[model samples]
Target: MSIFERMKQGATEAARKVEQTVEISKLKSQISTREKEIDRLYARTGKAVYDAYSRGDLSRSETEVMDYCEQLSDLHEDIKLIQEKITNIKLEKSCSACGKIVPVNARFCPDCGKKFPEDDEKPQESTVGEIRVLCAVCGTENDIGARYCVECGNELSPAAGDRSKPNDPAGDSIV
Candidate 1:
């Protein structure tokens, strides 16, 4: 056989091998996708079974299913505790009206416009050197120089002392 013919045959063989490799890779990718889809379906089925068990439609005789459900319940409680810790650390709370996160000191829900009940205890005054101006309307403390209350947007008294009442210009006013 001529050298040119042998070279042509070898090139054709190499091209076929490349095509086979590409086909195999594509098939593997498709298999992986199908496997993921199967996993999702399995999760949905498991959730449905768990829900049924929770609703008392399933019997307690199924100890395996009950154990898994108990584990999930414990995990959910743990998550709730972790979330509460996060909120406390951030000085935030969920608004009862909208379930949206708001500052712990907020007097109203920004999203739902729901007024929060005043706490029995007064808000603690700022530490030494940090002058806070208290709002007469909402009693929310603001920075010394702030013209408006941060929580209620009420006009603040220029004086930080005796914030319960606005400063009277006339000295004749009774204490």
Candidate 2:
């Protein structure tokens, strides 16, 4: 074949390969989307089963499902604890009157105008040597006077501790 003809043939073959690659990428994307949809459907089905178990509609005779339900319960508790830690890190408190989140230092709830108690006015102080000062961001135990966490280098609050006071009505405790 002539040099020009050989070059044309090579160009056509390269074009075809590019088209095939594009098509394969499109197919893979569609497959990934379908897989995500399937995962969501499975989650919904699991939620339905868990709801039934919680309502006493499903008995403990099904040991497999009971185990799954127990795992879900533990996961839910873990989620709650993590959420409380997040709230503490944000220095926020829920208003008792309206359940609206407000700044920890606020004397009254901005949304509900509910006055916070005297003990809730400020973050409770950490008694030196009596309690451990843990970094809220990294959960690393630090010395009472340490300004930052050693493990993650996250800043530790001076008043960080079990914020719950003996007189706190809600009796909220932080770790």
Candidate 3:
């Protein structure tokens, strides 16, 4: 082969390789999305059942059991399709968000708009528990649960030395 022909062939092979990799990555992502959808459907079905049980409504659950069963049947087909797509992928860089192939360590998915799918991005769980307090005076509560009532503007949990009531500017008249 001539020098030009050899160079062109080499370039063509490289381009083909890149194309294959991208196609494979896209296929994997598509499969991941589909599988996630199937999982979500199943979860919803489970939740519906649980809710029926929690409400002590056996009759309603029985009526809806057929619908849930049909959803599970549909999910099987979805899983099959996703598996086929996964098998066809030629390259793999699994997404962290949903566990599937990406074009590279891509920052965002061109297909799904997911950011940093193949990287650890889970938020750290907070260790501090929520705080709530009840006021013993004026029967009003504050969001900060401060030692004072927000509605009536009364100081809460007053010290014994400060137990004396303030002089009423309105002449101590009972309204």
TM-score of each model, paired residue for residue: 0.39, 0.35, 0.41
Greater lDDT among 2 and 3 belongs to 2
lDDT of 1 by residue, 22-89 (tens): 66566556555655655555575587677777888755435655565565565556556655655554
* Candidates sorted by lDDT, best first: 1, 2, 3
**Which portions of model 1 show Cα errors greater than 4 Å?**
1-61, 119-175
In the predicted model 3, the residue pairs found to clash are 95-100, 96-117
Report, for every candidate in turn, its global Cα lDDT versus the true structure: 0.60, 0.57, 0.52
Model 2 Cα lDDT, one tens digit per residue, 1-175: 9999989977986786587566656655655565565555557557767877888876543565566566556555655665565556556678788886755665554444456786876562332235455667767555544444534546555344223322233544333
- The regions of model 3 sitting more than 4 angstroms off are 62-65, 85-175
Q: Candidate order by TM-score, highest to lowest?
A: 3, 1, 2
Candidate 2 whole-model C-alpha lDDT, 0 to 1:
0.57
Q: Indicate the TM-score of model 3.
A: 0.41
* 2 or 3, greater by TM-score: 3
Candidate 1's displacement at residue 169, Å, is: 26
Model 1 error, position 73 (Å): 0.5
After best superposition, candidate 2 residue 44: deviation in angstroms?
10
